[model samples]
Target: MHRTDGTRSLAGLLALWGATRLVLLLAVFKVYVFPGPDVTSDVLVIYQGWYEVLRTGTFPLDDVTWQYPPAAALPILSPALLSFLDYAHAFFVLALVADLAVLALLLGTGTRPGRTVRGARVWVAGVPLLGPTVYARYDVMVTAVAVAALIAGTRRPRLMGALAGFGALLKVWPALLLIGAVRRRAWAAAAVTAGVLTTLFALAMPGAFAFLTFQRDRGTEVESLGALVFHVARHFGWDGQVLLNYGSVEFLGPYVDAVSTGALALTGIAFGWLLLWRMTATRFLPHTLADAAFVAVLMFTTTSRVISPQYMVWLVGLAAVCLCFRRTGMRVPAALVLSASCVTMLEFPLWFSHVVASDPLGVTLLFVRNGLLVLATLVAARRLWRTTVARPRPGTPRGSAGEREGASHADADPQGLPDAADPPGLPDADPRGGPLSGARRGLTSRASRGAG
Candidate 1:
């Protein structure tokens, strides 16, 4: 009966994914027109232009809008693999392939014993909520690499680090995926892989590192959290202009720099808080890696100066990984992110003109979307801190200190249940900050050995 139910759920998930992805493909392919703007224009024009330049063995040195990392050239040039199709069509096809790859990985991992298929559901639902924009951008491809890295991190630390390192070079945000990693092998492998790639790219491509200076004067994008200030200010005759700056719709007049600075400061504060969490954290459960990665990415994304619609893809992928471990407490934040993605689609390729004009509809969408992201970040951060930080309460019973110390790990199994059913007469973790032993140690070893 259990196997039959699981098979039915899998069938439903696949059907939904296929149906939604078919709609996305049709919209991007222009068989059906999506509202507001042509999201596929970027792929047809900007990405294709970059591909032409990259094929000549150099970066787009003259394009200020080419503000991505050096390794971004791979995805732009990836269309050559599908030589039969035009650049735009090939790019969309590759993007769809990457999307399918993520689903396959999530399904392979989420169906294991003690794990649940909730993560796959999150991905299947969240991607479509953002509309066809998911396939028109290379963020989906980058997200696939990050997801694979996180899944590999459970039992293959070296592989996780290597993938994370490669992913960071593709886009900068994947570097945060390693924030929760406890094994030293993951960090070391990441460093070596990144170092080698950096050297290789610098030697192989001219202006490979030029992207570092591309965003020196970027403003707060209209879709970002900081842009809310300008959107409201526009109604009061603040004399600000919304312009296409650095490839995004941004506020570029009175006091724009101030808000941008504030966003940067918030990002700094977020990093400091993450550092504190890492240093003070004690419990290292199987889900902690994914949980920490999800929290770290959420914090940075919410506080960024530019919150593009595609940024939500990264969050969805990470949230899926977090949910793969049924014991994870990130369900609320994942739901919040899903809600934010829907609003993002409306603000982007749907009602984008209103956003640029700072009209009521656009302003309301931005507020709700950014507010959801902020709430999700705070909730996720709090959960991560509470579960990992060792907080001994005052006047606690001395006899129960051992139990309290290991309470955080009690419900970290793949089934989201307490590990109290471990083999009898075996002890849990040591109360004095020593190593785990007995059945508890065996359970952790087993959990750590799996892909959960």
Candidate 2:
């Protein structure tokens, strides 16, 4: 009966995914026009132009907007694999394939004995919320790699590291997926993979590393958390121009540097907090890896100077990975991210003109979306810290919810489990049929005596 239910659930998930994805494909393919500005222009114009340049055995050295890492060339150039199709059509098809690949990875990991299908559900639902922009950006492909790495988790640390490294090269954000990896092997593997790939790209391509210099003059993007200050200031006669800077709309004028620098400082602080969490955290559940990664990415994303609409995909992917484990504390944060993705779609392709104009409707959308992200980041960080770093009270008894979670998954601990000498409520203890587990037996005995 359980298996039947599971099969039905899986079938339903697949059906929903197919329906939503067909809508996305139709939108991107121009069969059904999506609202707002044409999101496909990035792929049709910019990505295709870069593809032409990358195919000639060199990076886009002259293009200041070419600010991504060297491995970004692979996706830009991937459309050539479908040589029969035009560039934009082929890119959309590949994007859809990447989206399917992510769903498959989630299903493969989220259906195990201790896992849940909520992760697959999150992926199915979250992607469509961002609308067709999810398919137009190469970020979806990078997200696929990141999802695979998180699913690998502690069971396959080296594979996780390698994929994370490669994903970082693709977009630079996937490197945060390693924040919860306690294994030395994972770090070593990531360093080696990144080093080898960096060297190879540097040696083979004429301007493989030139992207480093392209972002030095970037301004605060209109959609970012810090951009709210400028958005309102614009109404009060602030002399700032919202121009297409470094391929995205940004505020370029006085005090823009200050806001951008503040964003960078916030990012630095986020890094500091993550490092402290890693050093102090002791509870290591199977889900901690994904939970920590989700938190880390949220911190960086929320504090970023450029919160592009597609950036929501990274959060959604990581959040889905966290929810795969039934015990993860990231459910609330994941919900917030999903909500933010919906709002992001509204602010972007739906009503982007208002946003760029700093109109009331646009300001409200940015506030709601950025506010959701900020709340999710804080809530996730607190939950992660409480679960892993904060210890129980001095005289607390065993078998508390947090303690049981850690004990049940103690096998996932990178360091060995606690010995008998450890404290009763310490996360590392063996419970051995504690009070909570024996409640049913106690209830049965009382009922039997009453009947007699």
Candidate 3:
């Protein structure tokens, strides 16, 4: 199909998807007044209590278990400014606005030179696929920030860092975006991030550190991938029980502590791997930062003690940004991530009872969802390794040191690597010759004279 036609079609699809998301949210809002098993806990419950605390001119430290960073206070307290609307309605509207903003950014990035509409496609489809939870949580706001930071990374490093730092305060994972940046860009971004974080902490002071204390004792949340080991262990007569702890479903009982510790250790290992990848990898494509960010988030999410459904939004948002870059080579990985998101919704708020009961269906859903995430993580990591670490083919022009510089300037595709062949308008050199045929011929003539 023509590109214009394809763009028009995608626009239509996005419109329909947005409308459906609105409908689903309205339906969810209607039921929020009288929540049941079908309706998961609303963000309003937490926000309302926190809003009241903010109104009293104090942090929500005493009233609510606010485990988020001090920067999170911005979004948490924002709904209070709209006092005309109930807290639930106001937070819902905020989430919707954030969601729309993310969509706009994705669409804008898609239109940029060297980007594709695939990123927009992922955004259009993945958000609603997660159902009303997309608008029912504040993660969408952080996601919007993440999308902005990633899209701005190549052209506006400082801006990207500032946004990422702001996002880090809202939720910690957004800071991971800086790891993919080059030394100078990473430094600029890190400095901006540190400034933002420092300013927020200075304002909040003692209250800002409250979240740190609160988070220190968290248990392994039942929905986390690591918890699956315990879930399966239950079948083998393990006596662990799932219960609400620290505002989440957690496994409690014999060896539960040990299991949670193991999960934390695994997370450390994941971070180490990311650090090693960053230090060792050489080739840096345009989409490399986004791809690395996705992998980092995936590693953190999958290995964490808590894999809240809302966390899936983080992965989906980054994956969409990754897909926008023509050279990211993450199309299938992005699809897998989106598919995992849909299954997350199914497992929660829908078949949660099954999951809670450790029933066959729930186990199967968790297995599938977690498995898809694992596969996406592995695939993305492999692609990243190949693009960054693998040597160019022996006969390929990119194998030459001089050609490597030229190849770096060539247009990259969605696979996150430049084409192996010479770029358009450039002559293809004979493979038997080194980088330049003239240089090879001159060397040959000298050798012939020496032989004579």
lDDT of each: 0.86, 0.86, 0.74
Tell me the tens digit of each residue's lDDT in model 2 across 296-360: 99999999999999999999999998888777899999999999999999999999999999999
Kindly report which residue stretches of model 2 are placed more than 4 angstroms away from their true locations once superposed. 392-452
RMSD of each: 4.2, 6.5, 7.3
Reference-based TM-score, model 1: 0.91
lDDT of candidate 3 vs native? 0.74
Q: Tens-digit lDDT track for model 1 on 123-223? A: 99999999999999999999999999998887788899999999999998889988988777889999998899989989999998888888776889989
Q: In model 3, what is the error at residue 264, expressed in angstroms?
A: 1.4
| Error in Å for residue 416 of model 2 | 14
In model 1, the worst 10-residue window by lDDT is 411-420
Taking all chains together, each candidate's TM-score versus the true structure is 0.91, 0.89, 0.85
Model 3 ranges off by over 4 Å: 1-7, 31-40, 392-452
